[model samples]
Target: MANYKPDLSCQNKFISVNFSEQIQLGTFEYALYYIVENKLDLSGSYAWYDKTGAVTYPPSGMLKIILLGYAHGLISSRRIARLTKQVFTL
Candidate 1:
């Protein structure tokens, strides 16, 4: 295993977010955007693909929050859901 985990440090009080002309947002939201933009492996997510038979894009808004939490190394499902609600809304 590598000696360090790079993602955990992302949860601290500060982080830098730079938006190009195509996108404009703060760090957390931007992080979510990044996570979504870099799509998940369709093969690995078997339940969604095989069991659900849902051959479509994952829920963008919800997935964005979950992905952002993961980017910050927050693995707790509840926390991810909570932050999703708190930070991003329709």
Candidate 2:
């Protein structure tokens, strides 16, 4: 057996920077988000229906994130959710 100890020095350190500021205005992700939000109308996709209570997220935004994940070959729902969170946080 070999002696092993974990190094914790860098583990607890955190750096804060705005990822939005770092992204160039003309980047593909930015352009895609913009087009999905403004240009592509998804109003017909939503149901003005009876009793689902309330919906928090818009269909267009969710579609954009899902499409982004699909573009990167993240086909599974779980992977897409994880990637969406990671992408949004950055």
Candidate 3:
């Protein structure tokens, strides 16, 4: 099983969003998230990291973010970063 970042959706944060509710079924984001989480074979990605040092974000999560940015035509890394901040910000 892959180690994933903690799911903090229910935490009382400054900006809270129930992603499952926000992303409706049959949508592109929904499909992307589902496919990456369930269908992809990410075992190879785990080989790159040893059980030491700082824990990095999962490949599946990174892939989802990048693909979503590309789908929205945000090619620049800076733009994508900004977009993500805006998205999670209040």
Best by lDDT: 3
Residue clash pairs of candidate 1: none
| Global Cα RMSD, each model | 12.9, 14.1, 2.5
TM-score of 3: 0.78
List the candidate 3 regions with Cα displacement exceeding 4 Å. 1-4, 9-14
Candidate 2 off by > 4 Å: 1-22, 47-52, 86-90
Poorest lDDT segment (10 consecutive residues) of candidate 2: 1-10
Candidate 2's residue-wise lDDT over 5-58, tens digit each?
332223423435444455468887888777886898666755533235543455
Using TM-score as the yardstick, the better of models 1 and 3 is: 3
lDDT of 3 by residue, 1-90 (tens): 444566554565555666666878999999998998899898898677675666567777788889999999989988998888887775
Give the clash total for candidate 1: 0
TM-score order, best first, reads: 3, 2, 1
Q: What is the lDDT of residue 85 in candidate 1?
A: 63
Write one digit per residue (lDDT tens) for candidate 1, span 1-90: 112223322343343432233355665665556655575543334243433332443444446656667878999998887876674232
